[model samples]
Every structure is written in C-alpha cells, then in structure tokens.
Target: MADFFPEEELLAAIDLGSNSFHLAIARLDHGEVRKVASMSEKVQLAAGLDADKVLSLEAQQRGLDCLSRFVGRLGSVTPQRMRIVATNALREATNAQEFIDKAQRILPKSIEIIAGREEARLIYLGVSHTTAAGGRRLVVDIGGGSTEFIIGQDFEPLQTESLQMGCVAYTRQFFLDGQINPMSFERAKAAARKEVTAIAAIYRETGWDTVVGSSGTIKAARQLLMQQGLTDEQGHITYAALEKLREQILKWKHTDDIYFEGLKEDRKAVLPAGLAILMGLFEILGIEKMGYSDGALREGVMYDLLGRFRHEDVRDRSVQALMARYYADPRQAERVALTARTLFEQVADALKLDEEDGDLLRRAAYLHEIGLAISHGSYHRHGAYLLEHSDVPGFSKVDQLRLSFLVGLHRRKLRVETRAQVLHAGGQSLLTLCLLLRLSVLFHHSRYDQVVPTFVLSIIDEKTWQLAVDQHGAEWPMLQADLQQEIVQFANWGIELDIVQLIKAEIEA
Candidate 1:
C-alpha cells in the first residue's frame, strides 16, 4: 500500500454488478471527482446462478476475467484507495467465497459484498451528488440481478429498498431462448408488477418531486426513446414513450431480431426484461416521467471513498447512530473504546491489524454493550443480533458480521467454533481483535470513571500475548481475578494470555 496518496492521485471503484462489471477511475479535484477513465463489460453473473443458489464456474470465470482486465487499467492506484463492491449476484450465491477468493487473487483489492439496502443507499448517494439536489427525489437503478429504489433529499436517503427483480434474472426467467412476443412481455411485466406491488403502497405514500433512473437498462431505454422522438427535448422517459417502446419490443420475434438505433448488442438480450420491469414500476408507482442520471453505484462508491479520505466517513456516523439508538453507556463505551485502541496500537503491527481493523475494533467495542439495553442476560448475543440484522448505512454486510462477531465474543467464554465460522476468511486477525476487545471489556468491568492503567502489551508470538499492568498487587484485585479467568478464556482459542503485575514482579525479585 502507498504511504501517501496525494489528493490529485487517482481513485477507483469497481462495481461487480450481477449483469455487468463496471470500473471507474477518477481524481479528486477540489472535493469533486474528475473522471480519467471508465470501463464496462457484460459479465452476466446473475445468469450463472443455479437453482441451488450456487454460482456456476463459467459465470465466476467471466467475472474474474473482466476484473483482470480492470486491474490492468488501474495504474498506480493502491489497493487501499480502490473500492470493489459486489451486489446481489454474489450476495445470493452460497459459494460466493470461492468466487471472491479467486477474484482477490486477480484484483488488487478485496471485494466487498454489500447488503441490498446498503447498495440502495450508495446508489442514492451517487445520484444525489451528480444530479441537482433539493426536493425529495426517487431514484431507481435496474441492474442484472436486482433493482434498487431510493427516495431522498440533498444526499440523504429517507427510504431505500432493493427488490429481487432485476433485468438479467428476469430475462432468463421470462424471455429465455431469445423468445420475444406480446405474451412473453406480458408475463415478464406481470411478474415484475407482482414484485413491485409489495412495496408500491409505501413508496407511493411517500412520493417524490422528481423520479430519476440510473444504470444501463434505464439509460438504454432513455436513449432509444430520444432517438425514436418519443421523448421531448429533455430526453426524459414518459409513460407514453415507454408504452410505445414496449409495442416495438413486442413486434420483435426474437432478441436478436430487435433493433434500435442506439441499442448495444450486449443489452439486446436483457432489454425486454428491463422494459417489463420499468413498465411495472411506472404503473405501480404512478410515475408519469423519469430523468436519467449517469451516476449510480460506481460513482457513489468513488464519492464514498473520497469522503473516507476527507474524514467524512459514513461508517463513523453509522456507529454513532447505533450507539445512540441502543442507549449504550457512553462513558463505559468510551472507556472500552479508548482501551481497545490502546491495546490495538500495541499489537497492530504484530497482528497485521491495519487502520481499518482498528476502526472495526473501536466500533465493536463501543457497540458491544448495546445488548444490555435489551437484557443483561447474554447481552453480547443480543448486541450481536442487532448489529447483524440492522440496516446500518455505509456498512457492508461483511463489516457488520465482523463487528457482530467481536461484540458477540466480548464478554463470554470463547466459542472457538462459532468464531471460526464467523471470521473464517479473516482467520487469526479477527480472532486477535476479538481477544483484544475481550481484554478491554474485562479491564473496564467496573464501568466507572477511572484513569486507564499504563500497561505494556507485548506479543511473544502469534499465539501468545503478555500484558504488564503498572499497578501493584491488591491495587486492583478485582481486575486481577478477571485477568486470571481471561487466561482460561484465551486458552480456549489456543492463545496464551499472561498478565504481569508490578507487585508480583517486585515480590519475585
């Protein structure tokens, strides 16, 4: 990783979308991104998923090959600066880890598979940043495996949703084998309408001043409409225009037989399914017209990356919101968080814990006791459940899981098997964080205001840790007992936790 990434240095975001893979590289100029290069390829990852929710080997290879090409274009940008996000395709795949492991070998950065709601939030962020912002706007992004619907104002999304009806998935379901006809289109629209109907009532009640569409399907429809003179000078998609396009689509006998002036060959197969989804959305939401925005997930990710560098990280805000909502003991939470940071600083390099890992530890430390708000009995489990399930903005699903794992293990006897499952890919690094958090919690068991002890934390090796407490014996007998139990706890995870108290050392000497 580069030690210093200048403001003018390039930043990149790769969206491993279900239908297509997209890469965007840009430089931050005066807090805004100036695009240097962008690439998109039809990977159709969603089409590769089987009935068992396993991604086919062929599909994984397509995605990996596309990423290999993208990695070639990402010149000089450090992996730390690039954000790679995977969407519904990977999220639904039971064997996504196999694909992710393969992808990581080829790409410079690890792939983050975001929850659907998080995807919606990022999509809204990108659209809001690029388009004019004022009144409440509804944003819709139709991707290969899923569609996201968001309503927000001035960069904050009030209501965000991700529906399972996506273009490529629907294309396979309703328009397989290149068949194109009125009946097929109607079947596709009816299926889409059924899906949208569930959320229509709520979204309609909370409506928008302007409706905007993002990503490939919407863009293709808007461009084709403009070329056909169905849209006005502004190139907005109207219901009447969509209906005409639907008619043109039904006239075609097969996907290849369909021809529009601006339609790309890659989009032809999935266009009808996309059109069906759009028509369903328009009817259900009562949308008369919608404008298009070039900004979507990739752009949103770039802006989010820029925000992290600018110290406006949304994850921090999310943690704060979680603490407040859970009515956490702020004083105790702060004490643990501070102590956790102290311990992390001592072992960060030794354990290969980066700043990101430190952030995860601190957040997990602050939120660890949140379960007390629910019940003191197994509060850690309660806290873990809350963090794991909540729609926390800016946190990817994996991020939440890691935090949950730490909070879940903060106080109790270590469940080695469970921790291994939760932090499988992370391995020792996450286990090390969990142990550090456990120690921090044990040290602050009293939860009263007190000066943190001056302690020397030394790593004897990867599996052993030594903590030299400054205080003499009987100065903190309660903490001494807790430390003794912690040794047994650490032993459960195959790590040695040795506590060195000043009084014991003096007596031995």
Candidate 2:
C-alpha cells in the first residue's frame, strides 16, 4: 500500500466545523484532485459553547477523539501536503487555544482558525472548482455554527461574508426545547432575516446569475426535499418546495418526532433551524431556487493546498492587493524585500529557519510601510493594527498575527512589550527576521535610486551578529549613526550587533 501511492501526490484536508469534523483525502490525477477517502462525524462542537463563549471540556474531548480517528486514516500524506482549518466555533470560543493545544497532541499538523471571510472564500473556491463555471454565482454554506455567503465568478470570489447564524447555533437559540411550532420557526426565520438584511442591499446590487448551496445543512435539506418529491429530480430547492418542507416540519410537535426518508438521524435535530435559516435567505435574497454541491470547506482546502504547491498561491495576490490599497511605495518595498531576502539566505541555516520563514519575512517587508497611509506618527503601530484586523483572504489568523508583529517592530525601539510579543508570534526566528527587515529599511532610508553601499552580514553566535560595510565609516556618517542606534535597540532585545567598516588603506594593503 505504501508503494502504491507517492507522498507528493497525496493531499489531505480536515474541516473542524462547528457541527461536524470532516476529513477529505485526495490524489493528484492529471492536475485534478480525485477523492480517495472521506469521513465526517457530528461532534457539534459549537453546541458545547457556554454563554460566556468557552468551549466545554466534553466538546473538546469529542473533537479530539474524532481527530484521532481521522489522523489514523491519513496514510502517507505528509504534513506539508495537508491543511486543517477550524471555522466559527473555534473563532468565537474564548478558550479556543485550550482546545487547539490538546488537539495538536493527537494530530500531526497544527489547526488554523481562519477568519469568517476567509472561510467564505475557501467555500467558493471549492464550489467553483467542482461545479461548472457560469456567470457570477452566489454560493451559500450553512454549517453548525455559522453560514458563509459568497458571490464570485469562475474561481475568484467577488464578495464574501460570514454571518453568526447556523443550524446548531439557531437550534440553541430558537429551538432549545426541541419544539417544532410556527412560533419558534417564526422567531428563527426572523433572526435569520435580520442577519441577512445587513448584506442584502449590496448583494442585490451585485447579483449572481445562479445560486448554489454547499456543506451539510443544504445537502441534507436538498436530499429530503428530493426524496419527498418536494423538488424536481435535479434536487433544486425552490421556495414552493421549501414552504412545503416547513409545513411538514411543523406537523411534528418536537424535533425527536421528526422523520424523513433521506434525512440522517443526527440531521433531524437541527433540520428545523436549518430550514428556517434557508427560508429566510430565500425570501430576503430573492433566491427562488438553489442547487446543492458536494464540494465544501474541506474540498476547498485541498484545492488551496494544490495551488500553493503549484506556485499559484493566492496569498501573493492578496499581499499585492493590500499594497496597492494602502498606496505603498513600490520601489522602497522592493528594496527592503530584496535586502531582507539576501540577509535571510545568509543566516537562515544558523537560525534554524526554513522557506516559510523567508516567505513571511519578504511579505512583512513589502507591507511594513502600509501604516503610512493613515498617519506618519507611529505608522508602524497603525500598520500592525490593520494587518491584525483586516480580512486577508488567504492568510490564517496566526499568519496575520505574525505578520503584524514583524511589521510593528520593523522600525521603532524594541521595548519590553516587544520581547513578549515576539515570543508570542514566533520567538527567536521571528526576532531575527525583524532585525533583517529593520536593517533593510535603514539601508533605504534615503529611498533614492542610488544604490546603497555593499555590506556583509554574518552570525557570530546565537546572540551576536557582525555587519561589514565596503566603505569607511566617514563616507556615510548618517548610516554610521543609524547603525549605532540600531546597536542600542538590538541590545534591548538581548542581541549584540558588531559593526565593521573596510577603509581604503586596509583594502589597498
């Protein structure tokens, strides 16, 4: 079995959803992904959240156990070839790190908690790749904890939004007693309507030609509707069919008594809330009929991983978009990026850094000046705040936080707070990248077309570095002074910087 599949050809994705955990394993077949194995378990992680937003221990255990089983099935899929993303449940959990820390012990890879909009983007990518391409399309995914709405053409998402309304969440809110009555349904539909209202005007303004739904709720709803002849053979859920489904749902006084030929036992409990949310969307967004797609978050994640492997990374495009939006100085950014890369290559091995570290450093260099768009005063702080808060499409939450830390500390004094933040972001490796970026920026302080003097940087030890310039100290007094100031800053962070200049006499001798 090991010899049958090459490691590089196998890719895996795990979606730690609010209601269920899903694992999808695919094989690269002629540039397309072919599913080899897939599994899903209803953990209902969001249902375990308390009013204060802490994930309960039992829920965490359930999630961990499910992950353990999924890991056992991930045969020969290397860590680099796999991606695991957690959606709304973990995003809102106050103690999400507590669960993540425990889950990491059972799984080989770390779990990334993606932003809501990013989640929307991935869902669109999954759907676009699997479904036929048409004009602008509206894709809706209803999960256990949140629902993502995206409008996109082809493989690119034009607009994406994720709302805090989902099957499990709404079940807890409007159907906690498991009662299936018109009053409860009305309240749930009203809540969903209100949430959809926030984005309706703009969505209507930028309309889609076809509407499609993905993930568990929509799939189960479509199946049940098709089985009952409520919809056509194509499995389209029309408003009329949805209305019929609602009437039948209200027939049962409670969720436990609800039964449908195609609906799974686990899906029955949340079906009413899911139906209410869908009906509200149909009315508010004027969606007459919607089609279901098997492709979802896990599938999207696998496609995204494939893109990275092919060097078609969406992150590079996202970074470029951010730079353009903030009116960054392209030449200056290029200068810093080039110099940072040069320094990284020289010291990467000594610092135990990898290609990922180098990539992060280069990106940080390009965006280090983004804060200048808002104000010149403490612009680094402004840039940090923006990166940390912005909905960058392809970056995970940790990726944003790490980028924020590097950009924030690129210039200013390395304060005590800086040390703590560096530790939290990436530790010694991140601090080293920050230093390289700082020097790169300092070298380009003039920001002119003239080239800076050549310099050599070497690591003396873990705590010390040596920089040798090709010209005498007197040739560039400003640069010399800047270096001295940098020495003090480096000292604050427990790093020693030694400067050396090559005089003409020494070169001649």
Candidate 3:
C-alpha cells in the first residue's frame, strides 16, 4: 500500500476503454492533478470481438501495438505506479485471461477489469471532481461496448447504472452496411431506448438538477452541435441540436461521406450509432439538454490510486460494509482477528511476510464466517462466492477475486497444490493467508467462552504448517477432532499440518 504514487512521483492511468485505449500521465500538486501528457489510439477492440466474445488475432495485435507505443512514453515508471483498467470488451470476452496474459508479456503490468457499476462510479467521480461543485448532476458516458449513466453530487454517486449499449456494438448491430438512413437511426435509437428503459423509472424518480455528458461520443456530439451555432462556447448539447443533427445524418446516405468538423477519424463510423444512443437517452429520460464534462473513468482511477496512500482506503470500508450487511458476529470476528494477528506477528520473522500480509490475514479472520449468515452448511464456500462476485467499490477486480478465493478455501479444501495452474499472482500469499484463517476459525469453533487459547505457528512453505497449542480444556476432544480434520484438508495444499498439544508442565496426578 505504501508504494502508492508519492505526491512527488509521477502517476499514470491507462484506460483500456471499449472504443480506444488511453494513457494519461499527470503530476500531483497539493492533491490537484496537472496533466503532463496524454495519449489515445482508436483501437476499436470492442468491434474486433467475435460473436463468441473472443478478440481476434488482428485486434489483439492492434491493441498490443498501440500499448507498445505507449510503453515507450512510460519512461521508468513501475507497473505499481500506473493503474490500467479494462472495460466492457474484456469483461465480455471469453478469452480475456489469455489476452491479458499476452498483454502482460509486453506491458509488464496486470490489468484490472472493473465491474459495470464500479465503472459508473469512477466515471461519476471523475466528472464530479473535475467539474465545479453545484447541484446534483446526471453524467452519461457512452463507451464502445457499454454506456454508463450516473447521478451524483459532491463527488459521491447517488445512483449509477451501466447498460450494454455502446457505439461499437450499436454500429455493428444497426449500421453494419455503413449507410445512415432515417429508419436506420430510428431503429438504433429504439434499441438504445429499450436498454435505457430498465432504469428510467428510478432515474426519473431520482432526477438530477443538471445533466452532464462525458466520453468521446458525447464530447464529439457537443462539438458538432457547437459548429451549428446552436450551443454557446460552454459546449452544451441540446435536444434541438440533436433534431438538426438527425436531419443532417439522414441527408448523408453513407457513413463514408458523412463528415463533421472536429470529429476524429476513428469516431466517424461509430458516430451515428453513438448519436442514436444519445438520442435514445434524451427521448426516454426527457433530458432537455446536457453539458459536456472533461473527465471520465481514467482520471477517477488515478484519484482512487492516490486515495489508497492517503489512508482513505475504500477497500477497508467496503469490507466492513460487507460484514455489517451480512450480520457477521462482530465479537467473534474481532477475537479471531486479534488471535490471528498475534500468531502472525509471532511467526512473521520465520514466515518472511510483511504488513500487507498482516492486513489480509486480519481482514480474512474478521469476515471468515460471513457465509454462515446465508446458511450453516457450506457457509465458507458461500462466503467465498459473495466476496468474489460482489461489486466492492474500493477494490480492484483482481483484489476482490483474491480475497474471495482465500475466504472460500479457508477451511473446506486447499486449492493450492497446483501452483503452476494458479491464475493469480498471489497464490502463495493466499495459501499462507488460508493457513492463518483456518487456525483462527478453528480456534473459535465453539461460540461460547470466546477467549482464544494461546498458540504458536511454524511455517514450512505451502505444503507443511505446524501449530502448537498451549491449552486443552474439557472440550479438548472436540478441538482435537477439528484440528485433525484440518490436517487432511491442508494436505490438499501439499502441506502437512502438525498440531502439538504442548501443555504447561503440570498434570493432576
């Protein structure tokens, strides 16, 4: 966590957006970001995805080639200093992991694929923080594979929803022939309206005082509308401008012939589709106008990265929220966490782990039995599922996945024997984490008499861990059975667990 971008050190955000990939490098001055450099290429990776949601060879090459160029500008920045976020395209891709594996070979950084709602939240953060603080604002960002709509005030999102309608996907579905007729635009708008309709009721009920549109599509739209002299220099988009734009789009028979001033070359083909989605949003939600916003997800990612260092970690808050939501036993969780930390600290010298390891162990101990709230049987597995699948605001996609995997494999079965096949970089860490979690859980197997007995731990890599217990009450038989059952499970991780019942040198003779 300390490796977070030092205020003096340069920071960067690489957004693997649906339509294009962008790299932004900036310097922090008193917490405000001053953009030093920025680069974006129209990769159209979303369009490159096949029906099976697999990125084609040509598409992968295009993305990698663009990243290679960006890599040159990164200078001496480590992967830890830069945050890379992949959007809906990878989220939908069946072979995303393979693509990521190949990408990491060239980029030397792991990519995070954020969930849709989280994406919406980040977009809102960027918009809110960049813009002046005023009344509640509705922000809409139309991406290549997903469109995010968020209503926020004061840098906090009030309501967020991400839809599967976007420029690239809409272009493919509605304008594949490259002809932009009135009926074609109407149909595209209709499809977009259908997607938006699901959230219309809630959005209307929780209406924003002002509407702001962000992203390449809306920005381009606002620029074009300004060209028509329909809007002022503020770059406001209006419903009447959309009406006139529709008339002009209908006049142009084909997309190749359609040219609007200030429109980027790559945005040409998808412009119509993007406009249609925008039109749909306006009509369905009755948005009279929308102001253009300069910020979006990439900027938000940088702020989030910086926040982790400033001690306002959203991850910790998200974890605590989960425990509270699930009605987890606070007393049990705290006791287990303290006991686990004591043992971890005692063995940290022998184990060669760090404070980060301590934090993870503490969190895992605190929330180990949250799944028990769902059901008594297989609660550990259920808890794992919840952690893995839930949309946690402060955590990166991979971070949540790793935590979930640890929780899942805590007591039931060790999924660490096959390290070669492990998908995450923290496989060893997870195994160590699971060992501590299991010990904590087993220590408090009974609900009453909550004080955890003293214990000592010795680590022997992934395959073997030994525990020395100092006390055995009348419940010794039950605890022995529990610890022995864990030994068999630990073997699955290729580790032998040796439980030493070392009593203080005293016996009732």
| TM-scores vs. true structure, each candidate | 0.96, 0.96, 0.92
Clashing pairs in 1: none
* Model 3, position 349: C-alpha lDDT score: 78
Model 3 bad stretches (over 4 Å): 2-5, 343-359, 413-426, 448-450, 472-478, 501-509
Off by over 4 Å in 1: 1-5, 473-475, 503-509
- Expressed as tens digits, the lDDT of each residue in 1-509 for candidate 1 is 23334776898999999999999999887767878899999999999999999999999999988988998998778787889999999999999999999998998787899999999999998999899885999999999999999999898998999999999999999898989988889998898888889888889888899999999999999999988789978788999999999888888889999898767898999999999999998988899889999999999999888788777889989988998998998899999999999999988988788988888899998899899889999999999999989989898888888888899888868866765675684667888888889988888877777665567688999778898886653337788888899999889888898888645554344
The deviation in Å at residue 332 for candidate 3 is 1.6
Q: In model 1, what lDDT does residue 500 have? A: 80
Winner of 1 and 3 under TM-score: 1
The count of residue-pair clashes in candidate 2 stands at 0
1 or 3, greater by lDDT: 1
Cand. 1 Cα-lDDT: 0.88
